[model samples]
Target: MDASDTIVNEIEKALKQLIVICNKYSLSGSLSTVNDLDNAFPSNLPRSTEVEFLYKNYNPEKLKIETGFTPIKIHSVSELSKAKMVMSAY
Candidate 1:
């Protein structure tokens, strides 16, 4: 399913408090707001996968290098623009 569908399903399940999902960025322009809870989040927590995440949003034509991240074009807002799985310290 698409990002929106996944979000809706996950949000419903989130009410159970099984896990905490932190949506870092609204990569897709379609997601205007999340009704479940406040989307405001603190930045720069710390991680190792940042390079991979950055690569996804990286600009091409301007720069290029080996082991480059494949460009993920978001044709539609419903489509998953991007997603990052971050392990937070609880």
Candidate 2:
């Protein structure tokens, strides 16, 4: 169980969540399996490990930055096919 293993699990989890949100909102979007997750991502990458939210105030031209920590995103695979498998009555 190396780092990439954990990251892969997280990526899969995120993909599932994304698919759920898309279904809930009736959004059509999904990347192909190969394109969804690159095998190279598991290795050293240049992407950030956290999300940054920038706040700007027009009152006095002030800016504030907030960072939300998150686990590293190493890999992802499409969940569209899996999610669409669930039958619906409509």
Candidate 3:
């Protein structure tokens, strides 16, 4: 087994574990979006424009370390709801 093969195996194992976790939580569906890069485990999130719910499980420190990427600004779902309510009031 080469380094690339080992990495692939690790990724596949991680994916299987993730699948089990998702199944346990009943989290399988188009409701989520999973973005993968370079065979790493994917970053999963709900596929909704609503900001409040979008960042439900987002952890900046963990994500940064895991993906080697800086976290982007994410609007909270509560903020989006308030904005909508304000707009409707007008």
Candidate 4:
């Protein structure tokens, strides 16, 4: 319904995938419940004002000039897993 909702769902999906991989490989970890996260980080406040400002004022060209590295363009949280797969293959 919204960007926040999409991000939350994507994060949960990633956690579930991690759980499956951990179970298969006998690794140790656990997925926190949505309620747990909500309790820890209430939605009433902004998550990170600094990150928000950076996102709003992001400049790829400036970054490239300063760092000499071209950043990969990623539009959403759901695209991260796909991007990771591609990078690993590369």
User: Largest TM-score belongs to which candidate?
Assistant: 4
Q: Model 2, range 36-71, lDDT digits (tens) per residue?
A: 234423333333321000001001111112235652
* Tens-digit lDDT string for candidate 1 (5-73): 666556546423321221233122221322321122213323223222222322121221223567433
Query: Which stretches of candidate 1 lie above 4 Å from their native place?
Result: 18-90
| Alpha carbon lDDT of each predicted model | 0.29, 0.33, 0.38, 0.40
Return the candidate ranking by lDDT, descending. Answer: 4, 3, 2, 1
| TM-score of each model, paired residue for residue | 0.18, 0.35, 0.33, 0.36
Candidate 2's error at 22, in angstroms?
A: 0.7
TM-score of 1: 0.18
**Model 2, stretches more than 4 Å misplaced?**
35-90
* lDDT, candidate 3, at 58: 30
RMSD of each: 17.6, 19.0, 14.4, 14.7
For candidate 3, lDDT tens digit of each residue in 49-88? 2222223333112111122476323223333444456667
- Of 1 and 3, the candidate ahead on lDDT is 3
